[model samples]
Target: MLNSVNRKVFLLYPNLIGYARAALLLLSVFAFHVGLLRFAVGSYAVSQLLDAVDGEVARRLGQCSEFGAALDMIIDRVSTIALYFAIAAKSARAGLLIFLLLLGDVGGHWLFMYTELKLGESHHKNSAHLPPGLKHPTSEAMHQKLMIGGNP
Candidate 1:
């Protein structure tokens, strides 16, 4: 059964929002590339706002799913890294810093996701199984304190 793909989650309101976010993110990057900073910023800001809105929309609409959550996560990281690339493109001096930051950003999130998948976490955001230090900065681990049901 092609469960994850067959659920028609691609049409869920939250997932649709995710698609919009992805499109807006691409628009932001392209706008930045084409020397449209204001447009890029506006698009990026809306995407970020939709990031927060998607979860709430999912919760309220009873539309939350692994697919939507995963979509949210993937886009969040991709957009952030894209912004870092934009910054690196502009600041010749901070290229190395951006490189290191993104390296850690991507690496840490990857490790955390790998761990979550190995443990069969239905929700990849859970992190109770990991060591204290392994909680990734870019992942929900940073919000452990603010999140309900997180390890105390």
Candidate 2:
């Protein structure tokens, strides 16, 4: 079913989808701040759906790239952590566990990204078409850059 649709629909508006996802994430945070916990949870779920759909759409449209995937992954991790923290605030025991879990998950993801960058695989796989300027000279360069407060 997905294959039959025109790819242009996805390609023409990836930025719009990204913005919508960001807005939804912001709304979820706002809802939590206002004590509408259920609404916040629902918003977070919707945001996740939007995030997944946008990536799938980008892929279907041949717009997939390592940069986009990395951005999406970072957003997903941050959103999940923020939402979990908000939820945890309502329950002491659950909150502690949630914090620990979030830390582990984020830490693991960071480690994997670090390793991939070191191996020079971060830019070679899904984003081989990236411009020369955007492509890292080598994995070592990427590792050094990342270690020195570079965006990854």
Candidate 3:
């Protein structure tokens, strides 16, 4: 069933796992809306935990594909956005933090992916292959400088 061209794409194990995570995230949003705090937190945590394993499952099973990667990325970003939006709805302090986080996450990932594609590099390679002129730096050096507040 796994190899047959007639087999449904949704039936693939990795894709099925991704769909389950998405469902959990959706439930998390609904739970948060209904003020079921424990349920919301648990669902969201499980979704994220699944995220860490889905890629490995795909790689080990030889199921990796551009479509799978795109699906994973979209689900991850949407989940993060939904989770933070829900938190922001509950607390003003969380709203401020969420605003900053969403801005950096959405904007930074946009630039990062754009540059990665433009440079003909895979997303797995990190920013080490990035050219010097790029503004969105994710290198360890850049992070160290930011952490130290210095020109290193």
Candidate 4:
């Protein structure tokens, strides 16, 4: 079911899916804030699931451009942060936890990007063959001695 053909179909609908996900997330946040929407949490959860689906679809369809990945990541981060803030506003007592979660989320993304960049560079310089599943390494993994400075 998760084949390339299905993935391509999914990619073709990215704009629709992306917009729907965004709308749902916003609605969920608004509902949560208003205290009238009982299923706001469920809607938010569904949005998150759709976010994952869009990414996997893009990747499997060979539509995984850097721009697309970046866009998706940015959207995901923004939505998550917005939700965190919304919840924190509802309960001031959770402020510290929200702050910590935001810090971890941002820091983790930065670290991963940095490592990927380094690995990519290393792959380009040293490895002759590409990585089994990856298109290319973003940067060389300095810590791993096995990877030569070139493409592999």
lDDT of model 2 at residue 98? 97
Please write out the lDDT profile of model 2 over residues 42-83, one tens digit for every residue.
877677666645555665676755546665776768787786
TM match of model 3 to true structure? 0.72
**Candidate 2 accuracy as TM-score:** 0.64
Error of 4 at 52 (Å): 2.4
lDDT at residue 20 of model 4 (Cα atoms): 76
- What order do you get sorting by TM-score, best first? 1, 3, 2, 4
> Could you give the candidate ranking by lDDT, starting with the highest?
1, 3, 2, 4
lDDT of each: 0.77, 0.64, 0.71, 0.62
Off by over 4 Å in 3: 1-10, 93-96, 125-152
Candidate 2 runs further than 4 Å off: 1-12, 122-152
- Give residue 116's error in model 2 in angstroms: 2.5
User: Candidate 1 lDDT, tens digit per residue, 2-52?
Assistant: 677676888999999999999999999999999999999999878877776
Worst 10 residues of 3 by lDDT: 143-152
lDDT of 2 at 137: 44
Clashing pairs for predicted structure model 2, backbone only: none
For candidate 3, write residues 18-114 as lDDT tens digits: 9998999999999988989899999987887776556657766878666677778788789879967987887877867898999987788778778
Q: What does candidate 4's lDDT look like per residue over 1-48, in tens digits?
A: 578865554446454567677788888888887885667887776777
